[model samples]
Target: MSRVPRIRFKGFEEDWEQRKLGELADIIGGGTPSTLNLEYWDGNIDWYSPAEIIDQIYVDRSQRKITELGFENSSAKMLPEGTVLFTSRAGIGKTAILAKKGCTNQGFQSIVPYSNKLDSYFIFSRTEELKKYGELVGAGSTFAEVSGRQMGNMQLMIPKTIGEQHIIGVLFSTFDRLITLHQRKLEKLKTIKKSMLENFFPQNGEKTPKIRFSGFIEDWEQRKLGEIVKEVNRVDENSNAPVMMITANDGFIEQSERYSTDNAGKSLKKYILLKRWELAYNHGASKIRPFGSCFALTRAANIRIPFVYHCFLALEDNPEFLEHTLNGKNVENQLRKIVSSGARMDGLLNISFQEYTSIFIRCPIRKEQDKIAILIKSLDHLITLHQSKLEKLQKIKKSMLESMFV
Candidate 1:
């Protein structure tokens, strides 16, 4: 029996032919122009690097463009519109088809089909599977790199007819488009929500916000955060709460979803019982997010947070409004004022609990706060919906690619 893909399109019975990539197409290597040469700097020519291939299957433009002189002076070659660009070193498995004529840096082992016989889309799909072999044969003293020769020698199970290859390529391409569309929508929704937050809340030293609901003309009252909320450090050893992690982006998430929860012989009494609607702030600092972060538990499940997190209860207040404000820049600067004047080796900020609670915050009455929070929360729901659709489409495409190829 001839070796074949697990799945096949209708009216296709011929087995795929096995051919080495070098025998089927000419593999072209790329290079960068000298940075010292000012004459070869920025121009109209599209110059591609591995970094530009992120979350995209087809590339019509490059993040950095080069001059014609740059392209000529370097080892870069002007590939045709259908050429397949595959990164060989950093971001090893990133692949994209050229939507227009372009030249790539030395990071890629691009393929120029000898004739129209090889479908660029099909080859792009196969590039994901070739990553394993590339890693196996790659060699370098400092970092692993796959050479053009190795890529050329890689074997591919090519379909007997171009018609069959087109069918499979089109199917995967459609799914990729849908995923990309949803991803763009999710980003746009988040951006809009951020704009709304900035306008709905008062800025530093400003008594009134730029935008507000009807009939509320009273200036927001300024008071110590401790006046409205009190610190809570309740610990329960026998509590059946789900162990959770307070993240910068996702707020409170189950510990098992992101990491292993193997606290061997550790006392559960040390873990704080985090009730729903309570606020938790991580004092740890990192390069990405300085001054730490805070979030209110919006999840339905009552979870147990680590003792390191500062937990507090909001009394006679809108929890969602507080959470939304904490996520904004207005509260970030207020929180920074109370942080101790020192940075830990691991980037943790030294924040005294007493000073943190004493920080002042300005807020409107309960009715206005509730209105703003409800509006922002609705946008969050829409973003989440789009994100779920994007993930589902990506998974479907991945499964199809696996079964459609050898």
Candidate 2:
């Protein structure tokens, strides 16, 4: 195996030492207190489970608390502040160093390093490395578990001086903080978009929303969908036009490498040659509410309307209104009724051209439709920008973990 080189700084040699975990620390596993005994729980003592520790960066708080009675009755041990906690099963291998005194369930093994030799932060980081090693050893097993004995026997390269360990720990902690800040920003942007979608659209019994396009005072007209537009399905095997996919969140895309291209052996010839502004629905998959299952396709075919895709996607008419309403509850219920069980496996909620066209829609003028589309599109762009930044930060963290550790 390759080894890290020793370096000298300020008249001191920083040599890395290879030693078993048991030689440097006391390995302690935990147990769950009986939930039936209410007297054991609901007190001031901090108690942690695997679920609570899985995603924690620092363990300052816990999901549950225990009393003196509970602590005495159970196998749980009160670990002091700065002890390293490592998960053992199920989600397996997550590690966190406690910031305060705490107790843990059987799912974790806490390591209390020998006084002044190893820092808690350095041990926590080493446990993370061991987790990856354990995954490789346990691959193909039905249930992978890392026993306390196995953990104690595992070997790691450690620096003799505590000062060097502290410096390495501080560097990684700074990266973790930056990643967390970007995550919070992404969450805030999502909340804003959700609120705007609800407020800008019509609500129950209010024909016209309080908000309107500038210089437009007309109330929207309620008309049957068939009167204004025609629904056509052209499912041709020979046509090589790109297979478009729809998603609930992203609307439509021309290419989808993530999904299979088979189309489930169903005939696409019956699918309409979608034009600009023409609306389409994925009636078959809408029942289960899968991601990218239902959305308006944006790319235009041979059609005349300017910004046809935006018109269908815009929050203007009752179709737009109906899209939101159907997405919530109505479509799922309606799909359940239409599903047919048979040998052909033709169990899908298909909206017929006649049935879909006959549905009534409340529509604003074309000019107002254009305006609403522009405003919502701007918000969508901002949401996408933040999402990209979050993804990039996550990638950087992953790369650092691979490079920084020996």
Candidate 3:
């Protein structure tokens, strides 16, 4: 079917044209200088490898530079500022527009657009789909790759007028910037939370935190974890219960996707039911966290977690405080102290309920603990809000890509 975009900018009434990429642009290939030659290694020109082309939308700088002598000796050619750099081998499908002149290894097949008929950003926006096509026609024994001849013959559907292409490119670029902004904000918030967690809690030998909130001047009390909470060992075959798994970094998340159906058969009885205000800990050792991770459930009463996780409820201490305290660096250090030398093949800690309860942890009074948890939780909420916005923008961009191009 011959068609145009579902959505178009005002005054763009003409239908888009379908043309082979080779007819619309000049295709260029790249190569590397001899590694054995020390003189050919480093100089003033930007040199990129397939590994260096990652999630970046545009690339201006490279990790390594090549000398003019090296460039003359190698098969690599200098691509212009607006050239679209696409990896055709090894790490296939990765693409970026050059913000400045650069050269890449033989792994890339770049495109230099004919500006009179094509817009660079417009070509850049289509690189993702082009990557899909490249993958389809690609062939290899060691790794899949699209040849330069294959890439040139690939077809592209684009607006007939350069003005329309420019408009569409700008619109998608704006959305990309918004997503990048939100992602940066989310990362900043997480870094702040990590910093605060370290500083808000006292060190191993200290009686008080380095930074304290106003009106909380007294030193924190040293309390055995056993003195604060008792392990809850309860389970039932309530098939209606929501199934969840405790992740080392992401906390509790639904594991329903792992199951074939909602009716999990006899396996449902093996699951542990957790009530509201309870704590769940992944007692398994992981590469990221040797002692595992723990978090308290703030959701309503019907959540069911796997039996692999150790469940506990606060009896004397504040539940919210215990959750954050255990996740903090000071308490994590305490956990590291008590872990048994022998870990199970499945990675579960050999430390039993008795050993976990006997571990000592430092804590502030209930009033101060509550205040700190509230402050940190508020920051978490803000981070979540921005993350959601970023996800939404990315989804919109995906939809636009589907409808705006043939």
lDDT per residue for candidate 1 within 237-326, as digits (tens), equals 898888887777777888888876666138456888888888887877755457677788887557887787888989977888987766
Task: Give stretches of model 1 more than 4 Å off.
Answer: 31-51, 62-76, 89-93, 105-107, 114-116, 141-144, 259-264, 286-288, 341-348
lDDT of 3 by residue, 1-406 (tens): 7668887778988888888998888888899999889888779999999898888889999998999999999999999999999999866788888999999999988989998888888988887788888888885445788888888999888888999989898998898788888888999999998888878888767999888999998988888887778787688874576788777766777876555435556666777888888898888877777787788888667677777677888986778778887776666677788886857987788777677777677888889998888988899899889988888898999999888987
Clashing pairs in 3: none
TM-scores for all candidates: the values are 0.87, 0.73, 0.89
Query: How high is the lDDT of residue 51 in model 3?
Result: 94
Off by over 4 Å in 3: 36-41, 141-143, 235-243, 257-263, 267-271, 285-287, 329-351
lDDT of 2 by residue, 1-406 (tens): 5344333234435457788888888878887779998998899889988887765678888889999999899999999888888777767778888899998988876788887777776677565687876565545468876777877887887777777667666766776777777778777877875666555554553556567767977777666655765444434556566666554555556434445556423544443355554465554443246211334444555222111112233333433344443343333444445444311244333444455445444556777665665666677777788788878877876676565444
lDDT for each candidate structure: 0.81, 0.63, 0.83
Against the true structure, whose lDDT is highest?
Answer: 3
Q: What is the lDDT of candidate 3?
A: 0.83
Q: Runs in model 2 with CA error above 4 Å?
A: 5-17, 34-37, 113-128, 133-144, 157-164, 203-228, 232-244, 254-256, 259-279, 284-294, 297-350, 353-372
